[model samples]
Target chain A: MDYTFQFGVIAKHLPYLIGGAWLSLLLAFLAFWAGAVIGLLGAMGKTFGGRVLYRVIDVYVVFFTNTPALVQIYVIFYGLPDLGIVLSPFNSVLLGLTLNCGAYLTEIQRAGFQSVRREELEAAETLGMSLWQTVRYVIAPHIAKTLYAPLSNFYIWIVLGSSMAGIFAVEELTGRAINVSSSTFRTIEVFTYTAGIYVVLTVVASALLALIGRHAFRVKARIF
Target chain B: MIERIVDEIPRFFTWYNTIFFLQAMGVTLALTLIGCGLGSIFGFALVYGRQTRGRLFTPVRVLIVGYVEIFRRIPFLVLLFIVLFTTEGFGVRVSFFGIALIAICVISTAYISEIIRAGFEAIHRNQWDAAEAMNFGRVATLRYVIMPQAWKVILPPAFAYFVMFIKDTALASQMGVLELTRVAKIFNDRGYSAFLTFGTCLLLYFILSYPLTRFGQRLERRLASSRNR
Candidate 1:
């Protein structure tokens, strides 16, 4: 099997690849933000709400945990249209990934929420803080401290997981690799180059997340 | 349509296709399991390597960091393609199945190593001193004193990662390995009821993974309670 490896042919597709990387960043960031907000709500519901709410959140986590993110994406990308609900490719992928991340984040945040000491809550109450104020000023900060590392880790996980968006033709970095591989007929070369791009993207994302952890959460995150 | 899908199941469950998909699932699952298993070993090795206080510790530390970063950064799909086509020389052509398994193991090792490292760090320092005071060697300490405890702490992360590994198997489907997702794709292309086909596939994966998550949660709770006691 004589196979010629040509860098030039694939090199021409660099711009598109870069664009895909940028799109991936956008997808991940949006999903991260959305997941964070929903995670907070779900965590709070599970922790503070009645049994029904807790049960609801429990089911949510089980469903999301059990299903593949790719399957989630496919369900939204392909399954929804069958129900007469048409979503754009990008929106469908983003929605799917965000919801998936939210479920995982909800579980992580719930752990953090459960860790806030009862004495701390009592102290907040003794200081005449309302329930909302106690949660806002006291509980949230405590959860923030415990949750920061896992949250950052989850952010990185979602960023890497977003590579699967390629399957949906969302024009993320992985999708571009598929295109490049088919066009170049150099499946190995195209994917290898894409692999390098992925490494850079993940590294950059991890570093940026670490920086955010330092500045935003004021927490020292040990990145392994 | 639902009745049609019900009928197709027994037809699709032919001897040849059954063997093919089961073999495919087996190949995919084995690749991930072995990859994760080897990765865990390497990961544990790094954890112990880091614990060895020495002048060369800095480089060892950097190597571990570099390993995790490199593997985690690259997409598995790309790794599969590259390793499958390349890495053939000296009269050794690594099979597609081989490359897929090796690639997953390579990636799994990086993550597993870090998880093991974290588990080690979570162990109280005094526990080591207690083991040392008992005249236990490093191996003995790890095996008898540390590992049982550390495994509990690591179970939540490791078990969660196992589920991630199962999901990651879908990526190999793109490389022409007919796993669940691949079969779903084939069914879709063949004008099978796409809804029933994919819905069933999704259900199958859910059935497989949900219990693992629940089991991990239970183990985690038990560990926490025992630690408190």
Candidate 2:
């Protein structure tokens, strides 16, 4: 119980850690957008495609969602080399996260698709709305309203989840913290600071997301 | 490379290795169950604390809220490191498994408390008023009225969180806990093909989680339908 605090050593490495924080955000942003594209397609296929297509996407979603992203990345980063396919740690973590995020987002976006009632679509059609107009004025808004909060929450989940990249040597915020703690031998202080950074990073991300959701989608996302 | 993996398969599934993997899976499950089980209890306590009224309870509510908001935002990996190092710094001789359990419990309590709070909030305010009119204390009201209704709403998401933790406990491997991922790392480091080792690790996790997920979905649907009725 006699451990003295040592913020002084970690102070010099603040910029390095900040750079790592930026990498964490960049990683989450990239994976989220990439996953969104995959999820959109998967949701569409599951909702409207043939049974075979539905089954394929279902399997992908099930497999990815059920497995840990860390192990999935482990398989990709370590196991893939056995099959003559090697990826950089960053690429492997990104690929793992994208696939995992896609599975969850597929489920989320699919729920959004289901939330659109048939009556609403029929009403738009009865109003003489074209396909694009119906999609724009009726369907898009409906989906956006239903999906915005969960999507933002998942984005923040990805931000937190991206800490897994540190284990794979990605040099993100957690990775840099590992480096500093190992080098400085200030394990507790280093991790405490890293956790603080993560808390601040996610709080800011949540607030920004809440603001965007409020204005853009009219969804009352909670900031805290 | 393919041939190498093929060659390693027979060796990988030996009786000893099979037992090793099964034991590792047990550790993973134990971590999830113990962690989330404790989490649910502490989470309910947190919800109760936060729901208390009066100026005296304001700090308690704020502290509970701050714990939830801050802990939920921190990544599990960082939390693990913090727990690991903090325990070390305090010179407590905790096992790696104990460290992992502490981290999981801390995070799950934060998350499950939010879920429990939302579940309680799902009950109508009039229900609380009715309980108050009957002279029921907060504990009595929660026990007799709110929990009966709220558990239906809480069970599905809480169960989903449990399943999520099954996969997440894989990170415990990073801190040298001999969980499934650690087993895979051990086998792979022992000259086994990574494809065979980690692939089996992935499949084992899928086996563990997929059924619980299906059950949670079914529970959600059933509860939703019954609630509507």
Candidate 3:
């Protein structure tokens, strides 16, 4: 337990690590929005489409949700080359994460969809509201209120989850930490600093998300 | 590509390979179960420590809160590396499995403590007051009053987390743990088709996790119904 603390060396690379943190956020942001689109379609299909469509969406959700994201990325990154379709490490990881997030978001969004009461929709129609107006004024607010907390939580999860991109040699926060630690032989200090950055990064992200949720949707989501 | 995978299918699913995968699957299951089983106990202790009332225990409570907050925010991969390097720096010899297990336990304790806290909060304050009126000590109150009600709320989400950890333990592969994902990588490195190796790896994970997930959902539904009743 007599190891020396050498924060000085790692401190010099703080800017490099911060740059990697931005890349991590960027990765999570892109994948989350892309996944949200896929999730919305899956949720809509599950809720409103026929039995066949429901079963197909169910299978997709079940398979993706059950399997590990790392393996999914491996398949896309390594296996796809066999079929003459090569993607960069970043693209493969992005594709894998989007598909995985889509499955979980489908389940979350489906719950939100079901939370919309039939009577409320009927009341909106009775007020001579057109379909677009009904969706805009009535359905959107109800869905947003119910879904905001879970969606924000899921975003934070994705931010943490994007650390896996480092495995594929993508220069995200964890990857750069690996690089710095290897070069300086300061594995412990580098990783401890990386962990601290993750904590601060996620906390700030959570507070900002809570603020957005409060202003945009009036949902009282917690920052902590 | 399809034909190549098809050709490798029979070769890949040999008796030796099946045995290799099953053993690796067992490691995966053991890691999750043991790590989380320990985590639940430690998590309950953390919740209990945080619930203590007194100026003397204030630092203890603050430390508990800080531990849970900081650990929950770090990614599992970072935590794994930190644990690995910290142990090495201390000149302590630990197996990769041991390192992974420690990492899993740390993260799960943070998460499950929150779940346990929520479960305890779900119980009415009157229950605590009622126990106090009977002169029951804190341990007796938790044992006789709170736990009987709180476990119903805790079990489902805790089980869901357990199922989620099955997939997460895949990251242990990066440290060469010979778990399911590591085994898959070995096969792929042996020049097996990635589709055959990693795809099978994915299916094996699904087999391990899907049933537990379904059971957790059912447990939630049944518990909700019973709670209503």
Candidate 4:
């Protein structure tokens, strides 16, 4: 078990690796924000919309939740071009991640929606609040309170899941590491460095989310 | 394009081709089963270690926590790549199937441990004393008293984790394993559209995953109702 560890090649590629990490973070951030919108709407639809809307959202959640996000990415990135709607690798990965994240977030946010009290909603209405206002002022606060922890975890999930984009040549964190490793044949150093970046990404993101939740949403969600 | 779906796709559904697909699914199921089986046992060990709180258990708890934190924090794909690529030069001669399975097992063990630990926490501390008073040994108490109850909480999500493992196996397609996703890749490599091939492939996955997910939900409801009664 005598193997020399080489940090030279990896050190040389540090800027490239950081670029990849930034891309991964960028993809995760976009997906999280977009997924949140989709999830919020889906939750609202299931809670109060017509039966058709409810059923549609239900199917979306089921299909996405049941399938692998990687498969979905493959399909979206590769399949849609046949129908004359081609997307670049970056667009494909983002679209893939946003839709998949939307499905899971729908389920998570629905749980938050279900936990809101019926009387509180009525009270909002009595105070002359419109539907959006009722949701914005009353339901949003309640859901945000409960959703902080799960959303924090979901955010981390997106960051990690974004690594799959590397396979499609997006050159995100993992992809960049693989390129350096394969080119340099410094598999141990490159991958170890990449994996370390991932750990730092998750840990730092968790702490940032906790602080955001405390200040913005007043949810005392623990980072651990 | 519609012609591709309606006609060209059917030619690929012959028994020989279907067998490849089935074999791939079989590999996936094997990965899931092996991962779940070994992962659960090891996860139970973690929770068992976690049940202790003295300075003597500090090292054990530290080791377990360190493992869970590292594995769980990292994406399974990254872990898979790390294991599949790094270990080969170290004289670990695991086959691609073995590599994929072990990677899944290692990652799954981390999550399963947390799940079982939470289940253990749900049980009352008084229950431990009750088992002690009844003259039950540690292993006996665990087998009879703790696991029987913990499993009621563990089994449903554990099944869902099975679904998750099935999905995770798809990532191993990059490792050259002939799983469903790789089978889809093989079809696509034949000048077929990756989208159409993997689209059909994902449907097959939906078929596999949808049932397990629904059943997990049903089991969760059953547990809830049975408890209420």
Candidate 5:
């Protein structure tokens, strides 16, 4: 019954833990940007591409959304080698998360596109805007405005889900926690601190997003 | 391409023992059901405890808030690591399945509680007052006045969440549960084709999850139609 708590054990290891946190944030950051691009393209394809492209986009969206991100990661990480395209753990995890995020964001952005009015599209057309120009000048800003809140939510989801990078031994926050726990055998201390840092990261980033959303985009980004 | 596809079919089936897949499916179902089932019970307890402004329940309310806040904010993988490792370090011998099952239940409770509480919040304040006027006990009020409306709101999304949690079962495979993902990994270790092994794994998961996806969509449509009246 005498379980002495050792707060001291993990104190000096704080820097390593934070370094891992930084990696988690970095991975999510990179994946989000990459995914945003893919999503923009995929959404465009679904919205404007012919039937063939629409069906291709649909398959990607349905499969990626339904399956676990981990399995998707496994397929790209393992299955790609079968096709002679080998990716490093960093590349594999990044690619997998990006593809998954792309699928979700494609749907999110498609909703944004649907919300764009015909008058706006016609106005852009009257101004001699090319298709790309119309999308960039007309559709993009509106999507940013309407989609900011949901995108912020997805950003936090990515932050948490990126913890799976640890499973691949990617030396992220969860990976470092596993390392420290096994080394010090202070399982509770290590993971408690790790989990605390994750919360702090998610909260701080979400608050920043909410603020940007409220002030810059006028979206009601009411995140707790 | 036809020949390649045909070759892959046999390579895929080489690892396909109906019993093996069934066993993995069984564990996956067990994890999802136990987690969602007990989680809903405990989550309802949390919700009901929080609703009571009784002096005795104040600490419980605070505890419930803190529990949901922590578990919801933090990722489940970290919680699983904490539980699996902490229990092991303390020399509390248990199977990884036991540890993973508890972790999933605890983690899912936070999410399920949040969704349920959203349903709880949608009930009008006057409804509760009416229940009080009718001399309903707390349990009776929740059962009769509150939950029916909440269930109408909660059932569709809650079922979707359960489908999501079924996929989450694969995460427990890292803790060494022989779930579908882990089974595929085992076969991959035996020098089989990764495409066929994990590809079949993907197919099995698709088969398992696709119907739930349809059901969730149907529930939403049904709820929307029923609401319009």
Candidate 6:
């Protein structure tokens, strides 16, 4: 319990920590965007595609949702080399996170899509819209309206979950903090500073998302 | 090179290693159970505090919100490292188990409180009015009427949270606690078989959590059917 609170050591590592934070943010942003694409496709597949596609998406969601993301990262980072397809630490972690985020996003977006009333879809169809157009002009916008808050939360989740990437020596904020802690033995200071950075990053991310939602997805005034 | 490594798996599972693994599982489970128990108690307090809006309501609200934000915002590994080692600053010694339990409770309480609040919100105002019309005392109404229903509604979410709590306990390993994952990490470091070690840890977590997942699903289904009726 004899721990030193050495701010100097941590101060020296602040640049590294910030760099790590940037990389972590990059990882989350890439995963979020990639996952959104995967999500849109998977949602469509699950909701409207043939039975085989639906079942495949169902299993994908189940497997990813049921397992811990940490375990998935470990498996991807460590197990892939055995099969002769080795990945860099960064790619392995990114691949694990993107796939995992994609699964959860698929479920969330599917729920949003399902919530789009049948009447609205029919209205779009009656206007001579093609299947793709109907989905684009009708279902996608409707789902986006209902999904902003949950999507924001999911973004925060991936940000937080990215902390696990440090385990694979991806050198994110937590990893940098650990290195500082080991060298300086200032465990408390190192982690506290890192956690503060995390809090700031997430709060900023959430604010940005909220503003985007307000500007991009605002609809006509609600009677309620 | 790979053959030499693959050939040593059987020898790694010595009697001592197997015993340590089982003991580590026990530690992990114990920490999870203790955390969940404390979390439930604090969680209920939070939900009630939020609902009642009594004299303590504003402070309680602020406290709960702050608690939830701080824990949820912070990474689990950071919290684990701090709590596991920071006690001497207060001139008191705390064991690793104590720190792990406290960290889990602190984190889980926020989630459990939200789940409990959701349960409370799910109860219709009409149901509350009906209970009041029956001349039930506040205690009796909560115990016999509101609670049973809320408890049922919260079970699926609470059970899911419990599984999360179990999995999170693995992070205690970073603090040098002899938990399942830590033991696996040790074995992996020594054996240089990261695949086997992490793979085993993954399997252990699945073995522990999958049953809870099934139970939660069943409870959710039952709740859905009853609600429909």
For every candidate, the chain B TM-score is: 0.82, 0.98, 0.98, 0.92, 0.91, 0.89
Task: Provide the lowest-lDDT 10-residue window in model 6 chain B.
Answer: B84-93
Interface RMSD of 4: 1.5
lDDT of each: 0.78, 0.93, 0.94, 0.86, 0.86, 0.79
TM-scores for every candidate against the unseen true structure: 0.85, 0.98, 0.98, 0.93, 0.90, 0.84
**Of the candidates shown, which would achieve the greatest lDDT relative to the real structure?**
3
Q: What's the residue-level lDDT of A79 in candidate 3?
A: 95
Candidate 3 accuracy as lDDT: 0.94
Per-residue C-alpha lDDT of model 5 across residues B1-229, encoded as one tens digit per residue:
2355467566556444657977888898888888888998888888877887878878888999898877877888888888886777677887988988899889888988888998888888999999999999999998888987778788887888898888888889888998898888887787766776777788878878888888898998888678521
Instruction: Output the better candidate (1/4) by TM-score.
Output: 4
lDDT tens digits, residues A88-149, model 1?
88898899888988898898988897889999999999999999999898987888789888
lDDT of 1 by residue, B1-229 (tens): 4576687787666787656555655665676678788878887887777677678688987777787768877767667767766664223476666767778888888778778878887889999999999899899999988898888778789877876788788777776666777777776677665666577667777766777767877887877788622
Q: Model 6 residue B176 lDDT?
A: 74
Ranking, DockQ, top scorer first: 3, 2, 4, 5, 1, 6
Off by over 4 Å in 2: B227-229
Error in Å for residue B119 of model 5 = 1.4
Q: Is candidate 1 or candidate 4 better by lDDT?
A: 4
| Per-residue alpha-carbon lDDT of candidate 4 for residues A41-102, written as tens digits (9 for 90 to 100) | 99889988999999999999999988888888888887888888989999999999999889
- TM-score of candidate 3 versus the correct structure, residues matched by position: 0.98
Model 4 stretches with alpha carbons more than 4 Å out:
A122-138, B129-137
State candidate 3's DockQ: 0.88
* Alpha-carbon runs more than 4 Å astray in model 3: B227-229
Query: Each prediction's DockQ?
Result: 0.47, 0.87, 0.88, 0.69, 0.56, 0.40
What are the per-residue Cα lDDT tens digits for candidate 5 across A1-224?
33456979899999999999999999999999899999999999999999999999999988988788888888888778878899988789999999999999999998888889999999999999999999888887898887887788899989999999999889999989888888997888889999999989988997899889888777776667
Give the Cα error of residue B84 in candidate 5, in Å. Answer: 0.7
